[model samples]
Target chain A: MKKTKKVRQEELKKTIEDSPFITDEELAKRFGVSIQTIRLDRMEMSIPELRERIKSVATQEWNETVKALPIEEVIGEVVDLELDERAISILDIKPEHVFSRNNIARGHHLFAQANSLAVAVINDELALTARSSIQFSRQVKLGERVVAKAAVKGEDERGQTIVQVQSFVENEEVFSGTFHMYRSNQ
Target chain B: MKKTKKVRQEELKKTIEDSPFITDEELAKRFGVSIQTIRLDRMEMSIPELRERIKSVATQEWNETVKALPIEEVIGEVVDLELDERAISILDIKPEHVFSRNNIARGHHLFAQANSLAVAVINDELALTARSSIQFSRQVKLGERVVAKAAVKGEDERGQTIVQVQSFVENEEVFSGTFHMYRSNQ
Candidate 1:
């Protein structure tokens, strides 16, 4: 039985959404189609490759308002962001992020994601850190996904923009930070 | 000419201060003495070995009050601590801490040291981080020593202890934070 292109594309979209990390080769094998056909279907459906798919979900138009760190250089993938207001990012802990013995993700990686997200939220051409206070509530182990949310809380006496970020692994809060950012414009 | 014991000890202390990272082997070569002699002189003057000296210069007693994480587990070496009031820690970035291509130390290593020091400060059995605000003033590179100082501020309305931490690399400030901590007693 031959599945039509319309049905195949819809099924492909559903499969990719269910497992965003699934590779093209695996998708081709599952669908019983040539790899070239899978690639063509993905292109026609406006779906990105595996790498981009992981970063593209739940994300706003990222490049326009973000001006601080280059998108590639940002610690985590920015999923949602609004200039001078709020932002959100997600990081998946990989083997490189953990201690070889404990498999616990290093604390600094959590901080970097939170810190970088805060900076991107209020980003000017350059945003220097003035100060911050943070706490690690729980340790994130390898394979945990950390979602960091940043909110701009008014200004301090020095006119530094205060951005607060909280990171969660599932429903549990793992880390949180409040950043005093010195924006080039502000 | 053989140097007197007093002169040798004085020069050794001065040398260690001038270059905190200088090894005893180097010092032995400079003074034309055995490594044992250099060790004896350092002990006589109450000067710690090269590793300890780097952390001990501006520190208070460390082992007494810290209760959050084990002493060895603390990210940076806790140099000065006065449990609940203030604490200080130092970390020297090595090869493992930096990006292989750039030698730029990961932001999380700095944050880990700062976060651990803050946790150790209140440290009543266990202290959880409720929130924090932070800023990174500069990028820390491999081989740079970071000195982190944590000060416990007053409690917030919710009874969370507010702690501020600032990390410096030499005379330049690299990172700072104001941490809101949920202490067990509070």
Candidate 2:
């Protein structure tokens, strides 16, 4: 059965609202329409691209991070988030993040992104960073997008989940940290 | 022989500028004047109390920190800072540091205060946090002043200076961390 244009557009809005990370091509496939038609529908509805939606979601989580978009081409937009297994997030360094003289992003901002992601990966009602060992090999400048990859490396003797996160700029490694997260007992 | 009033006031301002942590009683004794006279001079010169000055100094280091002064009477303002030995700093959580629903301070702010102090205690031209292991024993609320004390715990096998920072809300321990700091050879 073919749906009317008005009904399809309404459903499109609802779908995007429910899953902000859906790409335009995927939406077009889902709606059984041409890619160009999906683009036009998005433009008419004033809905931003997939990238904008991901940034907005991150901003709601942490007010200060990711107001600055990826100024360059996104190599990949893969956010692999699996509870108690692995999680990933992207942060672009904006003017606010860098020093006025150096344009170098502050170390704490980098740490915060990794630390919060470590907590997010835990399968618990509440999770906190028990301890973390972090190292900054290279300085991240403004406008660089940092992709943080966190993997759970099994539990320790204390039953704390050990999460290791490594952040990279494009392909170059920028920062790495290991977080021992405390999870609430179910 | 007695110094002129103008000369004494000029020296008082310079003394406070050089050592911001000096007490009013110490200033009075040093200038050979009554404490009341010192107070009057401070009032006339529009110089704030020692507490205000410490907050202002902390604010300069990180713009978002310590603007919210300690609301209650300070138990101790002991910032026992010795380069390459130990250093201490205080941070008061304010509106920006807390959640609207629950006025609990965010975990990352606590980490920043401790991490920055860990970096500051090193006697190098440039030092950074290579790694850290931190724990939050208790939740810190808004308006709570966290006193972070960092002490040098010698060097690791990797030649990294190990600094341990313990933060307290009054007498109760709130957070503690051990940081491996990277120091530049000067």
User: Top lDDT: which candidate number?
Assistant: 1
Residue B23 miss distance in model 1 (angstroms): 12
lDDT for B79 in candidate 1 is: 74
Which portions of model 1 miss their true places by more than 4 Å?
A1-88, A92-109, A118-128, A132-145, A149-186, B1-65, B80-82, B95-106, B135-139, B153-157
- Give all TM-scores, in the order shown: 0.54, 0.56
The sequence of per-residue lDDT tens digits that candidate 1 reaches over residues B12-66 is 8898888775677778999999999998898888888755765565455455757
The interface RMSD for candidate 1 is 4.5
lDDT measured at residue A34 in model 2 versus the true structure, 0 to 100: 94
Question: Candidate 1, A165: how far from true, in Å?
Answer: 4.7
Q: Give residue A117's error in model 1 in angstroms.
A: 3.3
True contacts kept of each: 0.68, 0.45
lDDT, candidate 2, equals: 0.72
